[model samples]
Target: MSISLLMAVYNPIEYDGRVKRSANALAEICNIKVICPAQDFSSDCFNPDAFDVMRVLSPKIKIQALKQIFFWVNFIFQAIKLRPSIIYAHDYYLIFPAWLAAFMTNAYLVYDAHELIIPNQGERISKRDNFFYFLESRFIKSADLVIAANQERANIMGEHYELKKIPLVVRNIPPMPKQTLSDKLVFRLYEKLEHEYQEDIHIIYMGDINLDRGIGDLINSLKYLPMRYKCILIGGGPSESLIKLSHSQDIIGKRLRLLGPVPHNHIPDLLRQGDIGFLSYSMVGRNNIYCAPNKIYEYAQSGLPIISTSQEPIVSILRKYKIGELLPIKDKNTPLKIAEYIKKISFSNEYKHAIRKFLLDNPHKSEMDKLKDAINGVIN
Candidate 1:
C-alpha cells in the first residue's frame, strides 16, 4: 500500500508528535511518504525508517489569501506524481487540496485533524475565517475518514460541518519509553530534592509557552508564592506578554528560569526533574475548550502529577483519573492553590504507577491498529 501524508506546516516534522506517530505506525503496512512545506525535515528517534520525505514550496505564510490557492495547485501535481492510494491530510487547513487531489487521482482521502479550525481564532472572526468555514462546510464530507485528536473535537466537527459520519479520536500520545529507569538516577534525584532544597519546590512547565497558556499568570502567581518555590518554563513562543516579569525577582534566575525549547527526546528526563507539570491553556476559543493536549500524557508518563484548569476536555480526564489537580485559571486564589498543591503533592511510587496504568489501559497501540485498518481498508 502507498500513502502520502500531507502536513502543511512551517514546523519541521521531527517536532510534530501526532504526524510522527501516525507516520511511524502506518509504515508497518504501507510505504509512508510525508509531504511538507520547505523546512527542515530531519529524521529523529520518532521516525520508522519506512518513509521517504519530499519538500515543496508553494505559498509563504505571510501572504494569507494565496495559501490555499498555491496549496491546491502544488498538491495536485504531487498527488498525480506520487500516485498514492491514499492522500492523508494532517489537518483541516489542507483538506480541500487533499480532497481535490484524491478526487482527481481516485485516491482515498483522510482528514487527520489535530485541532479544530474554529471560527474567530484571534478573539474575533475575520473575513478569512468566514471563507475557511464556508469551504470546510462545503468540502469536508468528501473525506473518506475524519480523524480527530479527541471525541469532543470529533463531535464539534460533526455538528459544525453537518457531516453525517463522526470523526475517530486518535489521541496524540507519545511512544512508550525505550530506556530503562535507573535506580541510581532515581535515588540521586530523590536525595538531591530531599537534602539540597528540602524547603523549596521545583516545578516545570514544558511545551509551547504563550500568554494564552497562562505564562503571564504563572509568573504572576510566582510573586505570591514563597521565595523557596521556583519554576522553570521550558519552551518558547511570543514573549511580549512575559516582558513585565523581566524586572521581577523570579526572572532574575533565582526563582524562575526560561529555558528555550530542547530536543523532543529530552522531555521525559526533563519531566523527571520537576515536581509538577502545568497544562494551563485559556479556554477562549472552541479549539482550546476541546483540546486534548499531549502534554498531560507526557507529564504523567514521566511520573509527574499535572496542575491544570477546570476546563471541559482536560478537566474531565484529570478529574476522572485523579492524576492531576484542576483549578480556576485567573482567580485570586489560583496561585494559592498552585502553591498548596506543590507543597502538599505526594509524588509516591504507587501514585505514579496508577497514572501509568491509566495511560497503559488507553495506550497509543490502538492508534496504530486503527490507522493501519483505515489505510488498508482504502487500499483494498
Candidate 2:
C-alpha cells in the first residue's frame, strides 16, 4: 500500500517555516496532508503545492478553553477518516487529538515539539500551558517518532519528559538559495534599499518583532552608532510598539526600516544585501535561554557576520564558527555594546571565509535527509 502522512499544526501553515520545510521533506517519501488553522475566513479553501491542506476555520466561541476543544475535536474527526500511515503533530496543543487519531487509526505517530511552552510568555508555566505540558508528557510516549526543532531542545525534551530516546534534531534553516544578492532578480525594494543605504552598514533582523525579542534595544542602539549604520527588520509583530521605540531615536523610516514579514523564498535575496545579522532573544523563558534560532544559518549562508545575545546554541555556534559577536544578555548598556561591536567589525572581512566554509560543510539538504530517514525508519 502507498504511504500517507497526516500533519497537524495550530498555526497558519504559510507562516510556519518548520511545518512547511518538514512537509516538503516528508512529501518525498509519503503522500502528505496537513491540517492547520486557517489564517482567516479567506484562507479556508487555500491550497499549496506538493501536499494537500485541510485548514480549519475556528468556531466563534468566546470561551478560550471551549474554542480549543472545538478545534481539537475537528482535527481528530478529520484525521481519523484519512487513515494515514503516519500522524504527525506539529505543536503541543494538537498532541491530544493527533495522539487520539493515531490510536484510532493505528497509524505511526510523530510528535514534532516546536515550542517548549505555548506562547512561552516567560520562565513560569501558566495554568493554560500546564495543561498542554501535561498532555505532551502523557501522549508523547505513544509516538512512533519524536522530532525536536533543534539539538538543545531535543536534549531538554528528553530530560523534561523522560522519554526513552531523545527526539531527532532538525534545524529550521532555509534551503540553499537559488539566487544571491548579486543575481539579477527584479526585486525593486531590495534595489531601492541598496541604493539608499549604499554607504551604510545594514544590520538585518528577520523574525518576530516584539519587546521580548529585544527590538527596542536594537533600535535604541542606533543612537550610539554612527549615521552610516542602519537597521532593517523583516518580520511581523506589534508595529505600534516598534514605531514608539523608533520615535525617540528619530530613525523610524530613515535608519530603521520595518519591512514586516516577507515570503520565505524572498529572504535569501533580502538577507544577502545585509552586512550583519542581528538576533536578541531576551533570556526570560526556557525557550529563549535554549533558542536554536535559524537566523544564524540564514545569515551565515548569506555571508553576513552576526551580532547577537549570549543565548545557548547561538553562543556555541558563534564560538565554534567565529561567524559573529555575542552581546551580554539583559545588560542595560546592551545598545551601546551593540554599537561598539558593530563599529569594531564594520570592515572586517575575517568572517567571509569562515561563513563560506561553514555553508559548504553544512547545508539544509543534509537536514532534510535526516528528517526523511527518521520517517522512513519508522515506516520500515
Of the candidates shown, which would achieve the greatest lDDT relative to the real structure?
Answer: 2
Root-mean-square deviation (CA) per prediction: 4.1, 2.9
- C-alpha local distance difference test of each model: 0.71, 0.82
Candidate 1 wrong stretches, greater than 4 Å: 1-11, 40-48, 57-71, 120-124, 179-200, 224-226, 346-350
lDDT comparing candidate 2 with the true structure: 0.82
Candidates in order, TM-scores: namely 0.86, 0.91
Judge candidate 2 at residue 116 and give its lDDT: 67
Candidate 2, pairs of clashing residues: none
Tens-digit lDDT track for model 1 on 59-147? Answer: 55677457656756777888888777788887657777887888888888888877677665345666776666666777788888888
